[model samples]
Target chain A: MTAVSIDSAPKTAARRRERLASGRTYISAALIFIWCLIPFYWMIVTAFRDVGYTFDSTPFFTHVTWDNFNTVFSESLGNHFGRNLLNSLFVAGVTTVVALLFGVFAAYALSRLEFRFKFLVLGFVLGASMFPGVALVTPLFQLFTNIGWYGTYQALIIPNISFVLPLTVYTLTSFFREMPWELEESARIDGCTQGQAFRKVIMPLAAPAVFTTAILAFIASWNEFLIASQLSNDQTKTVTVAIAYFAGAQAHQEPYTAVMAAGTVVTIPLVILVLIFQRKIVAGLTAGAVK
Target chain B: MSTLAQPKRAPETPSPKTKKVQKEVGQDRAATSQGRWAFWLISPALVLLAVVIVYPVVNAIIMAFQKDQGLDPVTKVFVQGGPAGFDNFVHWLAQQCGSAACAPGTLGAQFWSAVGTTFFFTVVTVVLETVLGFWMAVIMARTFRGRSALRAAVLVPWAIPTAVTAKLWFFIFAFDGIANKLFGTAILWTGSEWPARWAIIISDVWKTTPFMALLILAGLQIIPAEVYEAAKVDGASAWQRFTQITLPLVKPALMVAVLFRVLDALRMYDLPAIMTQGSNGTTTLSILVVDQIRQGFNSAAALSTITFLIIFLVAFIFVRFLGANAVASATPKTTKGQEK
Candidate 1:
């Protein structure tokens, strides 16, 4: 029994040492995870805390309530948060759909066709997206005004589509290029016409890329504050813009908690999207630089 | 081979009644039709881009040369008059340099300060983000427990909207908020010059470092495990293996990511505008351009052109010197058909 105990003691010590090393790794990992997450946690805790308690020294949930969320949704100063939500939905939705529709066509050609100046076309689209968007605001603002589109939904939708189309095209083109030749050829051999082959064979294959591009484009348009701020009025303001301009229901109050609640509302959808489509988001994000 | 290419037969020659020739003809027809289909498929996007993006950009460039007429009596909006012959450019430069004693409210002082602020923010944020992001990427690339959850933690900040991020940090940097509480000092992060600048920079870093890490992680993933294994077997230390094998392979992706972040940082607006309202010495080029829109289109156009040229030049250098497209195309190749 003494020999067996002696043998196991050192083994246990070795095991303990290994555990300590791994525990150190876990500690560092936990630090990074906490560093990344604290702001989000604070955002939620402040979002749920009673309004007056937001400025407290301790950054903990003491007086938790749903009052801030209720205030964000309820009417205040003639700016309806619910209406802003719908406006954001409409703008982001229309922008995503239109960009996808146009982008798919361009992406398909860019990927599969051996056209003249193919590289030039790709380069041009990429360069357009990189053009400082704010630089265009001067001209776009002027043009929108001349056409009487200022404070209108089209004002936001048009520019958002223009800016986001290049991203969609780039991502989807990369995806489409990776599609194997055999898939399309087989569809052709099955007596399907080119259009039918596209509809039946290519469309299904393209769906995930399309979905990824859509989410990306949607988030971009949804998160857009510059153009929306410049173009939209109270009636047509997007959630991002509205939240930026959020004021207290009563005078002289900062409406800090309500703003946090609004921020949470806007952020929840994106967080859920990143969680659900984490792989696709990573793939789409690193599409240009990683491969 | 029979299906891909058609055999060309002279009309004068005797008809070759073979299966191969028939298939070749089918292939020829298919090839021509495919090209036509491609053209049709691409035209809509090209047309839309031409009208929406290309046209306005050209118009803006042209408008830069013109003079701004104050509000049109009939239209009540500013109007573009005849060409000003570099008047706007001269006026813009003059504002920045002509008189050292110019009023703080003058456009020139504001312009130069904004230039300085933008440069500072870009350099500091890009440097910090690259270093921090590279570190995070190294951690992410390591095989570990709960790696995915850690990746998600990093991504959470990135997934949230920039405006929300700005607001989140704005509260944190408030005089009576968490930053002060944690540090045991009241820094007035958004109400002072350097403190406000740091606030903007820190918030930007927090939001975008994940993006940098994600890109770098992609670069790291493409480096094969066998290379490191071989290096270790050869008695190379971890540091040596990393410097020799990993750094060289990841350089292209790193350069592309940095250039992308640089371009993005130059156009930064949402964060600073939200965090400090461009007060406290945080007005960037974007904020200046937007601010000048109310004054006149001509000056703003000239400013816009300058900004565009700067961005274009940076992109040109990246593409020409570093071969950004080469590295860009590399990422997709590694990921090919994996999504399927």
Candidate 2:
């Protein structure tokens, strides 16, 4: 009885320690969740609150209303929030499509075909990715002004493609490299040309990777602000620039509540995309970093 | 019968040799075609990059040397200035104007302070992010209920646009806002220097720590569970196991995350720009560059070139000494068809 008691005592102690540890884990997890989500929560709460309650000291939700959201879409004070949303969509969409088209071919060649200066190509891509956007601002601003392309969708889309291509190429290249070469070889052996094999066999298999790349590229181009802020004018402004310069109904007052509403409107779609594709996004992100 | 068989075998051997030559020739043709296809495939991206990145970079450098188009100090008429060798560089680097030190509040005088502020933000935020991210990564790596939910929640901030992030926090940090209400302190977060810096740091840390965590979590997931089991069986404490096993193993991912965050923080503009408008001593190098661009284009060019060099230098140091393997990490490990 004593021996059994002694053995069981330690096991119970260990189990108790584990339970305590798990409890601690739960507490920390909750803390992390709060830390991550509080600002977003604050934004949502303020978005729905009446503009009169903008300075209300209450921490939790109160004075819920749809007025601020209305303000976001309303044409009052020359605010073009609705139009800016469409502009952002158009720019991000076209940038994604074009970048994906160019990136797929480049990534394929970089990963599959043996060639000299492959690393040089990769180096250029990486270097361009790391190049400071601010450095390009003055030159691009001048160049766009010279060519009369300033504040156009093309102006936004062209630079966005350059910035996003690196990410697309890197993610797709890593993915394409890991794909099973035997499938392509078998297709070739079955009287398929190389292009035909890539099109029929490899592309269908590559759809998921391509989708991941597209989502990432779209998100990136959507979030771009530095160049867009300078290059975009009133008509061509993106959601980000629009929010930055959002006008209040009054001349002097800052539109805090209205801006929060705009912020929520802009963030919700991205947050939804992220939540839905959380696993794929994580996979795509780490593919470049942790490979 | 033996002689006839010998002649037949010789004919067959030569035919085999001829087939070998044909196969080699076919392989050469295939290789050339692949190369041609690759060149065509990659040129479009290359051309776009050249036009966008390469040309702008070269132009920025050239503009750094040429003076901004403005009125000559002596002549009242606005005239396009000529080459001003080393003048733009001196304006920022030496903080000198003509023969005297630039006055305070001038953009030239802000160069060193911007550099200092940029480095400060980079170091402080990265350190905070690494520690917090490591902790979060450890938690996320564990098997638990609602893990997926936690991961999705963590991504909320990261998914938010930086401009929006700036606005979201701007509301929070406002006077009589939730932050003040919760803390019961009415400190002006954006109206002062240190508080403004902390506000930027806090917002940055909140936004990017998840990124660091995700990267570190990937590294942690790659660790074998048996390693921890073995350590436990050998009576290693949790702390010891973490320091001895997990820390060393996670270093590669951790370093990469830190390097990226550092480089990112160095060029930080949006957060501070929107939050404080780069006032109250929150002027980062990029902010300073933009500010200078408004008043003096040539000097801003020089400032940006300097900024680029600084970032390049840091990246070089990281790759050279710290073994960050930035390039290798981006490259694929396996080539064609030796898949295990």
Candidate 3:
């Protein structure tokens, strides 16, 4: 008891010393917070500015307004913000569903199956992603053209899935591997079919990782710009291409309150999505990473 | 069904015939067990990947050959020998691809140089961000108040869409804009090449370092606290503890952070596309491809080929040589490599 007390004496003193040394942490944290907020603050300020305010230094304070939002939602864009929002939602939803469904299976295989050339398969997926998406536009353009798939949602969706597949596969695989081996062993000994056991137990348990990957795939697909531009000519433009170009040349010229409004419009949903999945994403990515 | 669901408790002293029958059934089930689990777990991702990745990649490789210009919607029919073979390669090399005859400075070697620029952008940004992020993660890990808020705030840049990020930088860095007003009388924020790219590089580093830091923080959590205590008790300095105690344990995490960032930086398109549009020397591989496709250049296919190669190389090398520990460590927590 006396020895334990002596140990505690030093530990308590050490903790006090450590706490004193950490005084700088609060200051650094505050600075980081301010730095992070500035960009978002700039974006919000620009979104509320009047037409010519953005060009001058006075834009920061000349009075914030709804004019940009008013223009974006009501008068400016050919397609209303609501409709573009729909387009973004639908695309994101589809991408999430497909990516998750496939991702789960690939993960299971990598986690469990001792299939031939499994490592090579992993490499192939990684390698495919390495293809600079922009440079492949030529081949994608040609491929889509020959098949008459150009300017279609399939054009965009198919390529998006392909690009994300390798990372998603690896991501989920790592997730599956992290799962307890004991559960699988117990299920096998209990005489449940392997498929039934996985369905009844494993899939349910992996839900968080699944949801995380789904959100990521959805966000990437939703925020995507280039593929949307090439795949859609006029009929099927996405929110990104819609807001960046077709909606306004004022991205450079004339009244950017509308453009700023459009920019704000374009960013909100994904931000919300990030918040929703932030913790899960952190869990999923870390699980996949920490082997 | 409920009876079937009951656990098959081992019979203590069963009749010989009943025992034989039970044992046969159990053996039969076990025989197919692994196979069933294997297929059940493996097929969904494998099939989807094959369809999405395997098919398109194979098809795209085939498409890179041939002058498929006849297939152009603007044109009525197919042109067979339409500069299909090495012509796209030659034209890309000669800088004749998007020269005024095509689209002026966006295609061919200009495009390849953009690929080179993309590599430059990715390497510089990844290196800087990784170092900064590691330091930040270390700082944040120390006990402090307002740390949660700071962590949340750091993510603010990442949460904002890239297009929005471009605008924020544009606001700060544009000629006659707040950047110049606040800092000096005259500066080229966008008109010149290096300054324009530097603006983007700075914004990217700001936007992404949080991601790296958060990831490293997650990795940092894995090291045993006892180890740090022991090191400290041994009179280790801050630098030694970081290098000796912290770094080796956190290396896998660091690699995962770096690999993810490198792959991401290589695929960078929207940032450059929105900001500089390959104007000046700010062009990256992605910008070049977009420009070529938009211009109807035959080399657009060739550009995609080269760009894909760069990203693929980075992904492969990072995953291959960097060790799986880094990838596995960072997977579910930091980068969203997780699947449901």
Candidate 4:
């Protein structure tokens, strides 16, 4: 009985040491996690806390309430805010699909086809990608105005296409170049039309890359504040612009919590998108700006 | 940030009918046709760029040379003006008795000062970010428990949407907000000029320092352990190894990181727009351009061109000094090399 107890006790001691080491890692991780979460935490807390409590200069603990969120959901501001979110989603969704079509086809051609002036075209597009987007905003506003497309989806859609296309094409082109050729050739030999082969074979292989491209394009379109602000006057304002306008038009910044609540609303899909495809996204992001 | 972007190594997809292309080439040595099927395929994108990017950019350049005759850009009608060559330049130079917003030396009152402030903000933020990013990267690159968590933790700030981030910072820096509470009394973080610039810079740094680290980490992952081991055996201090060894080896990625951050910083819009709304000395080139356009000035086109030139010059200096290689050789070629 003593022997068994001694053996079990030593095992427990070793387990205790292991537990201590793990505890250290957990505590360190928790600390880092808290630091990471502070902004998000404060955002949520401020979003929920009453306006009076938000400004309370007390050194410590404040009780929470969902008054702001409740107010947001039960008001005209909430209704407009919700509509704008939908507008951003719809605009972003359409923009992504269109950008993919342009970027992917261009990538396919650049990657596979032997064309004259190819290098010049490549250089021009790549150079254009680096051109400050802000510089183009003025000209675009003019162009959109000229086309009688002001305050419309056509205004945001076309420019969004241009902005996201270079990156999309650049990325997809590189991804397409890296793909093995045999799958394409074999399918070609098996009587698959180039389009069908692409649709069936190349596209499936490129699906992961496509997802990365689409997600980014969507996010860029959604977060686009400058263009959305300038071009969309009322009917077509995106959520970001709408929220900013909402903040600005306030008698005071009365909707501080509401603005953040709106941000939380806008952030949901993005956070989900980031979390779900974190690995693919990590590679895309790290490598994206490099090229 | 990964959600924001990823490298698309231009797909080098081999032609499916290379034999056909080769045969067609040899058969038609005196080719008269406009390129090939590939050109046709890429034309839609080519056309989009041609109109949206190429046409506007080329137009901006032409407009810069032409006199700004207070005309409608869309209608091309001179509502209140005539061609006055070098007058716009002189006006911008503040040589022709202009307002303080167009003043020569003092910042808060001149166009030249606005330009200076833009450069100043870009330099300070980029320099600070690089230093902080490198420090964070060095910590991350070391082998330790919870490294992945640490990496992800750093990435969270970067992943938050810019509008959300800007607004969050706005709240934090708001009068009677957390910033004021912490500093005691309501500090005007954004309402004024220099304070507003600082506030914008602070918010920008918080959001983007992680981006700088991620880029540098890509560089750090490529450094072979043997080099570090050798340095350690030679009893090199951390600073020596960092300066003499790490910096030199990772110079390429570092440059790319800096170049990207600089170009990005030059186009400061969102943070400043929200933080100060172009008030005070925080009026950047972008905000200035936006204002001119919003004012319905034909000169706005000319102004955008000038901004483009400034941005291009900055980009050129970065490219020239940084080796201009987009293909990051600092990325270790093998999977095993990813282990730090």
Instruction: Give the candidate number with the greatest TM-score.
Output: 2
Candidate 4, A1-291: lDDT as tens digits: 112455787888967987886676566556645656677667766776667676664433466676666555554543476667777888888988888887888877766654455665665666666677666777778777888888888777777776788777777766665577678767866888767888898888988888887877787778888778888866788888866756422566556777777677777667767767766666656653443
List, for all models, the DockQ compared with the true complex.
0.48, 0.54, 0.37, 0.31
Candidate 2 A-chain TM-score: 0.95
Each candidate structure's TM-score, on Cα atoms with residue i matched to residue i, is 0.89, 0.93, 0.83, 0.81
lDDT per residue (tens digit) for residues A1-291 in model 1: 122455887989967987886786677678879989999989989999987788875667779899888888877565588999999999999999999999998898777654445666776788767768777788989998999988899988988877788888888887776676578777767777768878888999889989998999899889888888888888789998888888767777668788999999989989998998998998888877765
Q: Which residue pairs in candidate 2 collide? A: none
Off by over 4 Å in 3: A1-20, A55-62, A75-79, A113-116, A129-131, A180-191, A246-255, B1-37, B68-84, B93-106, B294-298, B315-340
lDDT of 4 at B109: 31
The window of 10 residues in a row where model 1 chain A has the poorest summed lDDT is A1-10
Ranking by DockQ: 2, 1, 3, 4
| DockQ of predicted candidate 1 | 0.48
Candidate 1 lDDT by residue in tens digits, B74-109: 467766578777867765666632224345776645
Q: Candidate 2 lDDT, tens digit per residue, A1-291?
A: 122455787989977988998998899899999999988988888899999999886768899999888888888668888899999999999999988998999998888886666766876787677777888887777788889999899888877877898889888887887688778877876878879999999999999999999999999999989889988888899999888878887778778899999999999999999999999899887776775
Please identify which of the two predictions, 3 or 4, would achieve the higher TM-score against the true structure.
3
- lDDT of each residue in B52-90, candidate 4, tens digit only: 777877766555555544554357666555565655555
Off by over 4 Å in 4: A1-36, A57-62, A70-79, A111-119, A177-182, A185-197, A247-250, A288-291, B1-37, B61-79, B95-109, B183-186, B230-237, B327-340
> In model 3, how well does chain A match by TM-score?
0.83
